[model samples]
Target: MSFKTIAAILQGEQEFQRVLDCAIPLASRLEAHLVGIHAEVLPVPYTAAAGFPDTDFIQVSTELNKEATLKLRGTFHERVEDAGLSFEWRTLESFSGDGTLAGLPNVRAADLIVAAQRDVESDDGTDVESLVYDAGRPVLMVPHSGPILSSFRRVLLAWNGSREAARATFDALPLLIEADQTDILIIDPPESSDDTPDAAGSRIAASLGRHGVSVGVSVRNSQGQSVETLIQDRLAASGADLLVLGAYSHSWLRELLFGGVTRSILRSAPVTVFLSR
Candidate 1:
């Protein structure tokens, strides 16, 4: 249940240090091999009126991208060498619009993926959503604006009694077992044929308790507020260092159209989020 290999996605110079700040400590703690993945995007050449390619534009863009990749690689090597962690770097040239797709293969091979939270302001062309949904591995998303967490001491699990929730609960077992406190929080729980609202989080609490996790259950009525809002409020109030939850319990298409819980939380989670599909 422990991570043996960690994949850290490096998008740009701005996020590289922050992602490494989180990934290095996590790898050190888990004693896992760290793999740094960078996707160098190739700019598309424009066609002339006669369909001739713009060679000069293409050449300049290629050189700039190459230089940027080299600089990022150098920084990665320097940091990893100083950290003294077992590490490797994988760099790929991506021609597609989504640069992060270039690192998909490495991400698929790793036990866990560490990535920076998406920057809504910039269109950097990185596809973190694809990595999270398609990587076939758990992803720990570091907040874009927060102090990096050295350890997950207090964990909060968002449970909804769905298959995805159950999967996430077990997928995060190692962290939960190690946490000093793990709270199972259920909001606006649906009335199941077998379970009641008052006891919504009881089942999962019991299961985690059996695994030797210091677990507690809390059920809160949404009271017409968005579930995402409540989750953030709770995270702030409890000062939980990490949040564990299932990703896309609803279909991706549905979430895109209707704004599901997973999407909301992914956009603005207050703490580090561990998500498993």
Candidate 2:
């Protein structure tokens, strides 16, 4: 029920330090093995003027990437050692130039994955948006803006009675068990044959209560507003720092055709988000 190993996705020098700030303290609190994963893009063997293999271009590119990677490695050691926390650094060469996609195998092996949410204003992020859907593990996405949280004190769990929501609720058990309070939110619940709309969140609340989590259920009327909008409003009011969400409860095609809750939240969540598929 506790995270034994946490893989922090370090994407170059852009925000590696911020990612570490979120990962290190949590790892220390959980006493988990912290893994630092970074990927360097391999030089593409494009043709020269004469269409011959350009060795010089490849060699220079390789060296430059290596130099940057080594520097990042040094930074990792200096910070982690200073904290007196156990850690391991992993580096890989990605042909696709996407570290998040390249480190899938290693990330899958860990108990949890910590990633930075893509900066909504910039297009420079290295495929960080795809990590949540593809990782097959619960991902804690740190917001690119706002105050970084060293601990998750208040939590908000979004529930819709879907399989994805169920998976997310259980995946967040470790954190919920430690939180001071957890609120389950269900918006505009549909009529169910087995359960009533009033009790939509009640069942889940009772289940979580068994785990010793201080839990409460809240049902809100969306009132024509988007689900993401209401969720964000609640987050601001409740002052919850962490949001536990089930990603892609609907099909991929369905989400693409119509705007999805998962997609909207991923792009614009103000606080840290815990996403599970």
Candidate 3:
């Protein structure tokens, strides 16, 4: 029940160090391998047609991008050395196409994906978006400025009985079962009347119990609070450091038309959240 491999996307010197600082501590706690990924987007090729001008455009773009990549690689190596952790750095040089990073083999091999919230106006503001969607891993998105987590002492499981929620719960088992306190909170249409005192909740609780985890379950009516608001309120009141939930309850279009819980959580959560879909 520990992370074995952690993959983090390196964007720049400052942000890369910030994410590494957050991730290395967690890696040390888990005794995990840290794999730093520098996804290098090669400059787009602009071949000049016959008699066309600007022959040096592609060469200049390539040189500039290479320089940026080298600087970032140097920074990553120094940070990894400073942390004194077993780590590996990888570089992928390619022209970014739709589904580029998604196809990366390294991303598929990692147990956890750590991402930093990037400020817009960088990389045309597309790097963060692509990493979140295409990483194909359970992403731990670190905010640009927040208290970094050393442990999942308190965890809140946002349950809705959907497949995605189930996946999220299972994916977070390592943290949940080891946490100081773990609460499985379900909010929905309402608990069923025919449901036994311990039915679905007990099943999950039992599994954790076998792991010797301190666990509890509770059901609450949404009571008109938006899912985001409800989650934030629970985070504040319970002092939970991690939240486990399904990602993207509804499709993008449907959620946009009518707010969905998953969308709200992704947009902003009061605490660190682990999501799977």
Candidate 4:
């Protein structure tokens, strides 16, 4: 019903602090054990045209990565000490490739994973998609740069009647129940013989109401605009602090090639997003 263990992905100096800033308060609020995971990528030696390896470059890169890891660990310990919460630090060394992959084990074990939204502009080589898709747990993605979330009050649930949507809604029940108000926003609803827009929304609202959550439903037509645009507009209008939705309801490869709702939301949702695949 509540998060018992929360895993936070720490990528760089600035992002580490930002993710921790949000994760600390969330862990405190839920009284959950916090785990900080840092994946240290080891540099591989490059070969010259004649097949000679650049040993010096490799050695220097290794030392730099080690120093960075040490500094990050020290900062993590200091922050955890100040917070005085149940916490653990995990450091994984990447021997093969994409150091962030080393943290997958911790991600798999966690009840919830906290990570920063991907920054395509200044990417730090963190594979956030893998963490979300491969972890098999709900991911709480904080905006790369936005208002820090000390708590979630108003929540907006993006419902589309997919299994992923249902899972995300249930997974976020703890937050929904705790929120002052939760709005269900149905955009460009499908025309089904069995259910109308109002009927579909009412069914979910009634379920949430049974759990003692203050629930409201709104169906928007989107007016021929992208669903993501409409969702963002609604989010601002509703003033919801958190967004709960299923991730990648469509095929991942399809989304990667042709844009989909999941990709659009991940790239530019202003508020915190709770996503499960």
Models 1 onward score TM values of 0.94, 0.95, 0.83, 0.94
Clashes counted in candidate 3 amount to 0
Query: What RMSD does each model have against the real structure?
Result: 1.7, 1.5, 3.3, 1.7
Question: What does candidate 4's lDDT look like per residue over 183-236, in tens digits?
Answer: 999987777888876676888889999999999999999888988888899999
Model 3 agreement with the true structure over 27-95: per-residue lDDT tens digits: 877878888777676666565776565559867877787788888778777777777878988877767
Which of the two, 3 or 4, has more TM-score? 4
- Which 10 successive residues of model 2 have the least lDDT summed? 123-132
Per-residue lDDT tens digits for candidate 2, residues 1-277, read 7999999988757678778889988998888899999998899997899989899999999999899989989999998888888899999888775678889999998889988878878875656547877888889888888888857889999999889999999998999998999999999988879778887888889999999999988899898999999999999999999999999998767886887999888889999999898
Instruction: Provide the global lDDT of candidate 1 against the true structure.
Output: 0.85
| Arranged by lDDT, best first | 2, 4, 1, 3
Measure candidate 3: CA RMSD: 3.3
| Candidate with the larger lDDT of 1 and 2 | 2
Error of 4 at 7 (Å): 0.4
lDDT of 1 by residue, 106-221 (tens): 78889888888887777663566677788888888888887888578899899988888888889888889889999889988889788899878887898899999999888999
Q: Which candidate number would show the highest TM-score if scored against the true structure?
A: 2
Error of 2 at 32 (Å): 0.3
Model 2, residue 58: distance off in Å is 1.8
Q: Count the backbone clashes (under 3 Å) in each candidate.
A: 0, 0, 0, 0
